[model samples]
Structure formats: structure tokens, C-alpha cells
Target: MMKYSTSPTPSTSSYPRSTSPLPAPANYQPTTASAAVKRYKYLRRLFKFNQMDFEFAAWQMVYLFVAPQKVFRNFNYRKHTKSQFARDDPAFLVLLSVWLFLSSMFFALCIGLSSGQIALFVLFVVFVDFIGAGILVSTIFWYVSNKYLSVDGAGGDVEWGYAFDVHINAFFPPLSLLHCFQILLFHNLLSHSGFLACFVSNTFWLASIVYYLYITFLGYSNLPMIKNARAFLLPLPALFVLYVGTLLANWNLSHMLMDFYHYRVL
Candidate 1:
């Protein structure tokens, strides 16, 4: 009654009510769980395990070294259309990495290093041989492929990662053989039969080298960019050159390491 001429009271229903939820603020952040889930999914897909069968993949990997031609023929590069930037089988790459690591450890163990020293040696091999050398060789192959091979008219392009994939796949057989020879040599399994040991080790080494050359040749020959045999053979000389250069570069370091092992552990 104080203000007798009262207007309608400004009640809670005076303004309109929103049916939709409010928009997230500009500074809004996702929950940690949500982010982790997304990362896990991404990693799984990237590694190609989402679509791969473990047993089949393992068999195929073994076949890659044993029956390379059959494996190569079965390989369909076009299937990896999603990997326009980087085309490689993540499973194969991972297997190769693991093999490298295990081979390094085996060598270190054969040298009779202490546990701590073996661990360090394995780390060195993983970092220097696997990571560093892999990157260097892959880069070289990529450059050679793009520069020399003309892919302009071809249906497919030579991606850097794909080139690396080819390089690694082609060389894997030789690497495995070489590792086997090293293991045998180090373990003295055939030490009593010196001639047999020498013959077997040399056979493995020679076969590895020959297989590497043959595989590289076959790999390049099948490329879309290389049309003629002459063009196909061009990469071979470059590969040999790179191989020799890499060996020369690492010779001193390898010798030093061997000497250290012999003096300290053997």
C-alpha cells in the first residue's frame, strides 16, 4: 500500500528462458580422460593394428625375408591411399626396429660385457645405428628416387616414407642373415671346426650382400617411375655408393668399439 499505483512485479518469469545449454567459454578445455582416449585411438590407427591380424602379419613378415618375390607381388601400395604423405607398414617398421634392438643386445652379450655396459652398448646401437643411420640412408634414397626417377607421368608418386619403406624392406633379409652370422661367430658355436665356421659365416655374409643387391634391383625395377631397364639400374650405383660411404664413415667407430670390447670384456 506504500506505492498504491503498483505496476506488475518483476518476477522470475519476466525474461525469456533458454532451452539449449550455454556455449562453452573461449578458454574451455577438454577433460584429461577425453584427450587420452583420443590419443590412444590415434596411435592405434597409426600403428595399423586396428585392421591387421597379428598372426597373419607375423607370417607375412617372415615371408618377406624368405620368399621376397611372393611378398613383393602381394604388396599393394595403392591400398595405403590414406598415407599420402607417409606410406609405410607400421607393423613391418616396428618389427625391423625390434630386430635391430635384439641383434644389438645379442652382439653386446657375445662380447661378454657386464650388464650395465651391455645396456649402454644396446642404447648406442639403437640410437646411432637404428635411428641415425636409418634416417640418413632413407633421406639419401628419397633424394635419389625423386631426383633421378621421373614419376611425373606415372600413376603413383614416390613419397619419402614410401621410398624408405622400400629401402628397408629390400635390405631386411640381408640384415637378418648378417645378424645370424654375427651371432654364430660371437658364440663360438663352430669354433672347433674352424674351416666350417669360416665357410658358413662367409657364405652368410656373401649371400646377404648378393641378396641386398638383387632385392634393391628388383625393388627399383618394379617402381612406377622406372619405365625402362636402364632407368631402373640407375639407383643401383647410387645405393652402392651410399653403402660404401656409410661403411667408411662408420669403420673407425666400429673398430674402436670392437677393440674396446676385446680389451675390456673379452
Candidate 2:
């Protein structure tokens, strides 16, 4: 006791002594820290992508880029990949079409073409937009088709078959409009007061989009096999409804424009 009092008390190491004696499971696997982390992260991603059973790596990469982060941020990616990916919602298409149509009309009338020549000019703008849409859609289809064929051994050509699915939503239409809008803005800046010129340009844009949608639909839908038959047919009913809706919307928008103009004058 006298000798111990002279020296400092010995400290215990970090390791703890367990009083309970529990046997370790016989088949317990010791996972490395890095491997465990990777597994956990993968599970989170899987849960986030909603376990979309994406077969091809190309689409997976596309999803990783295009997909909204909110869809996956809370989950483990690893756990979700065990299943198949589901198709996009049909309502999303309808909503996108409506929004695109409304936006196009507004931009064409207000900025691209003057409010005075709203009708014909808007139509023209829509036409040019469609043409550009065709090119863009075709390119996307080509890229996806090539990727899909390389991986899955399906889709004969990039022309009309599987390409229809590529343009099912208002994806191409809106994208093309965005591109045309930028160029048209530049044109508007250059020729500030030439309504007729702007109208003509806008007409070309609209006509191009209409033509592309029509031709592409006819080409893909009328194909020999059941290639895009399902996708094409699905849109027909929706387009009919959209056509009627667009007329009503355009009419209402026109009235609103007139009211605003009158109010400004008053």
C-alpha cells in the first residue's frame, strides 16, 4: 500500500471488458468498413430511384443525370436495383403538353412576334418549333437506339420503330421550342419592328413542328410490326383532347391579352 501510494494510478485501455458472455454467431461475416459503406450507399440509391428496374446501363446513366434528386435522396440506392423500372406517368405527358402549348403561345405573341399579329405569327412560330423538334427527337432516338441495340439486341433501326417512344411526351416539342426561342430572341433584337418578318419566321417554326409530329407519328404508328403502335396509339386520344383544349385555351388567352391592352390604355 505504501509503495502504491507513491506511484500514479494505472489507467485502463480503450477496450471494455464485457461482463455478459454471449457467443458469436457461427456464420458471422466480417465486412470491411469501405465495403459496408458501399453496400449501404447502393441500397440508398436503389430506394431513391424507386427501385426502377433499369436493365441497360445506358438508361441507368441517363436516369442518374436526368432524374430529380428528390426521387432518391432519402433512400439507399443499393436496395432499390433488385426490381424493374416503371414507365413514366401518362398525366405527366398531358400536363407537359398543356404547359408547353401555353408557354409557346405566350412567347410567340409577346416577345418573338408582336401582339398585333398574334394569331398567324404564333402559328408560324409553332411550325418552326416543330421542325427543330424533329431534328432533336431524331437525334435522341438515334442515341438511345444505338445504346439499346448495343446492350439489349433489340430495335432494328433508328428510323421509325422504337423512336416513337422517344417522343411520346412533350419532351421534344418543348425542348425544340426552347432552342427556337433563343434564336428568335436574337432575331427580335436585330429587327425590332419587323412584325411580318418575325411572323414569317415563327410560321416556319410552327409548321416544322406540326409536320414533324404528323410525319413521325404516321411513320412510327404505321410500321409493319408492333413497334411503336402502343406508344403512338396512346397519344392519339390525348392529342384529340389537347387539340380541343388548346383552342379553348388560346381563345381565353386572346381575350386576356385584349383586356390587358385595353386596361393599359385606360
Candidate 3:
């Protein structure tokens, strides 16, 4: 009547003026609720030995040293399928914890630590070096990467758990190199004051640091939303300079580390 045309009325279903928001997909949910659920589930299974997938964690450990980039590829797949980058299974953490314990024991023995000293040594390594430092580092990287390195309008956020995982991954090769392999050769080579000892020990330290940086780069670069992950490797040149400095100064890193640990425990 009032010059109405053939335009049809907008469907309420498609163009609602007011309605509840859509439900999240199965893999995606509100953050607080999802985090609470995940935490509860992860902790509940922590002591439940049978429920943890140790095999997968072992596989990750092997790949971490030999083919580290391949290890991160699985993280990408997990992000797609689980809608999160962090691991749900506690197996890797469990394996890492066990490794830290065993390696620390061997380290204490190699350093001629007494029973009480060994206890203190293991406690320092497991608690301060691994857990406390891990949390601090994880928080720092999580904040920095999300704040500065995340791509603009990338949408997804970096989880603290994922950051911790990266730390543990980077920590592994160094632990084995320093605690296990270095211990094997400590008395023979690394503890000596010879040039060959300086070169070899410093080289091992250099390699350990490089592994940490490279693994960290792989972890962050694997993320679809992260940019400039090459920033992780930026320290390599400085580390090399420091390595050469240590060699020239005849600073046996492993010997110094042994002395430091023994001093701490004493």
C-alpha cells in the first residue's frame, strides 16, 4: 500500500536482532572452562601410570635429538585436531622427570658427592633448575612471543603449557650432553686444563646452546600464527663469540659447572 515492493521479509533464523551466541565446536570452548577441565584431567592422570602414553613420549625424546623439526610437525597436527598447541598427555613430562632424576644421580656419582650431597644435588636440579626455572622461562617467552612476535590479527594465542613444552624440549639435549655424556668424559677430558680439553668442553657447551636455540626456533616457527621466530636463533653468533672467549680463556665449562654444583650441595 505504501509503495511496498517485491522484497521479502528477512528471516528471523538467519538475521536475528537478538539471540544467544553460537556454541563452540567440540575441540574449542571458552578459555577458563576449558583450562580448568584440561588441568583437572591432566593432573588426575599424572599418578595413574597405566594411562600415560610413555611410548609416544619416548618417541618424541628420540626425535628431539635426531630430527627435532620432525618433532614439531606433530605439534602442528595436534593443534589442528585438538584445537590447542599444548600437550594433553603427561607422558612427556613424566619421562623428562625420570630422565632428570637418573641423570642427576649419575652426575652426583661422577662428582663424588656423598649421600646427603647427592640428595641436595638432585633436589636442586629437579626443583630449581627444571621446575622453577622452567616456569619463569615459560612465562617470559609466553608473554614476549604473544606480545611482540605474534602475527597481527593471527587470532590464536600461545598457551603457557606450550611454552613450557618448548623449554623442556630444548633442555633435553643439553641435559644429556652435560649431565650424561660430559660426565662420561669429565675425569678424562673435560676436567683437564689442556687446550684439547678446553676446545672439546667449550665445543660441547656451544653445541648444547645451539641445540637449545634451534629447538626453540623450531617450536615457535612451527606455529601458524608466529612470525620472526628466527629471533630465537639471533643469539647464536653471540654464543659463538662467547664460546671462543671461553676457549681462549681456558675456561672448562663442565669443570666449572661441576665445581659450582659441588659447592652448592656442600
Candidate 4:
């Protein structure tokens, strides 16, 4: 037998040692500022405003009013998918808010509101009445759907985000029409028209509002989770009450502002 060397021979490895640096930690936490910047970028992307998007959104707004079922059927809830609804687009909402603000400002000017009153009107009517109310109503619907009814066969809950999309799309047409009527009236466009024209315009506005409510009813009725008529009807009363209450609150706020302005002037 060959005598084995007592000393170990130098090892000859064919593989080179890994010179590559180890990968950074997979769960590395971003700095707070970096995270904030990421969110800002995300929001910018989500709310991107372009002329084509605006035109499409305007068309969808009309389509939503004319053929809501088709619109709802086509609505994409996934953030990754592109959406036509203004509610789904931040830029659209921003545009809408700006339009509302300008409209309210014009109304205030037409009414001869003081600067303070105009400010209040912009704050309350544009911001609170429209945007805030949309959010609040959507939340209410979302809560009612989740709390009282099983939305899907799999017990999937109604998401507030989707509720908001539905609510805003269904709600905005009538609301915008109402604003348009106000604008026309304030600008004396209706004054030049005969009584019949005025009557027709007012009637149209009222019909549009009724249609808005009807569309809302149809919206909830179409949900897969709403199994029976009773389930469908349950949410209606609350929604109607909320709708009426919003109108009353807006009226009251306007009157109160006018009264306060007069008092101050006196």
C-alpha cells in the first residue's frame, strides 16, 4: 500500500470564489421621504390629465347618464386597468372640482355675494357639498352593502372605492345639469327665452334628477350580492334620505350665508 502523505496537499478547486457582491436585503425599508415621493409619483400617474382623457371622460359622463348599465358593466375596478369613469381618474376629479369651483364662483358673483361669502361658497359648495358629499354617500352605501347584505356569492365585500366610482358616475350628470341650469339662469340666458323654454328647461332638469335617482336604484339592484327585492329595497330609503338631506343642507347653507351677509352689510 502506498503510504499516504501525513500533510494535506493544497486543494485545487475549479470554481472561482463568488466575487459578486451579495444582493441587498429583499425587505429593505425605504426612507419616509422616499416613500412619500413614491406615493406622489403614484398619485400623479393615477390622476394624469390629458386632453384625450378629458374628452373621453366627458363622453363617458354622458354615456353614464344615457346608458348606465352598459357603463357599469364595462367599469374596471382593478387599478392596473384603465378606466373611463372620472371617479377612477384623479385628473378627471381634479378637473371636475375645478369646473365646479369656477361655476360656484360665477354663481356667487351673479348673486352679488361678498368676497367672504364667495369664499364660503367655494369652500362649502364645491369642496364640501360636491366632493365631500360624494365621498360620504359612497361610504354609506359601502357600509350598508357590507353590513346588511352579502354582495357576492363568495361573501366578497363591497369596496368603498368601487362604490365611490359608481356613486360619482351616477351622481355627477344630474348635479352638473343642475349647475348648468343655475349658470344659464344667472347669466340671463333663460330670461331671453319665452316662458315655455324656461318651463321646458326646468322640467328637463327635474327629469334628469329623477333619472339620477332611478339610475342609482338600478345600480344597487344590479349588484350580484343583492339577492332579493327586499335586500335591494333596503338601501334605497337611506340613500333617498341622504339625497334629500344633502339638498336641504345646501339650501340652508346658502340661505344662511346670504342672511349673514345682509346682516353684516346692514
Backbone N/Cα/C clashes per model: 0, 36, 0, 2
Tell me the tens digit of each residue's lDDT in model 4 across 1-266. 53442222322223332212233345544233333454465466664444224554555566666665544433422211321111334544555666677777776676677888778767777657777888898888778767776545643455555576667666667666655654465335433334443454454455556666666655655455544424534555665565556454433222333455445434
Question: How much lDDT does each candidate structure score?
Answer: 0.54, 0.38, 0.81, 0.53
In model 3, which residue pairs have backbone atoms overlapping below 3 Å?
Answer: none
Candidate 4: Cα lDDT at 185: 52
**Model 4 misplaced stretches (Cα beyond 4 Å):** 1-47, 50-52, 76-88, 186-205, 228-266
lDDT for 253 in candidate 3 is: 86
In candidate 4, which residue pairs get closer than 3 Å at backbone N, Cα or C atoms, i.e. clash?
Answer: 47-91, 151-225
How much does candidate 1 score in TM-score?
0.61
Higher-lDDT candidate of 1 and 2: 1
Q: How far is each candidate from the true structure, as Cα RMSD in Å? A: 20.2, 21.4, 13.8, 19.3
Question: Among all windows of ten consecutive residues in candidate 4, which has the lowest summed lDDT?
Answer: 77-86
1-266, model 3: which lDDT tens digit per residue? 33432212222232212112234446664344376677788788898877666767887898789878767655655565566678878888999999999999998998899999999999999999999999999899999999999998877788888998999999999999988987888888777888999898888899898999999998988776788989999999899899889888888887788779978987
Model 3 residue 21 lDDT?
A: 28
TM-score of every model? 0.61, 0.28, 0.87, 0.58
- After superposition, the stretches of candidate 2 with alpha carbons farther than 4 Å from their true spots are 1-88, 112-117, 121-149, 152-266
Rank ordering of all candidates by lDDT, starting from the highest? 3, 1, 4, 2
Alpha carbon deviation, residue 112, candidate 4 (Å) = 2.0
Writing each residue's lDDT as its tens digit, candidate 1 over 38-153 gives 34554566566544334444554676666655444323322222223232236666667778778767777766678888877777667776668767877776676667765666
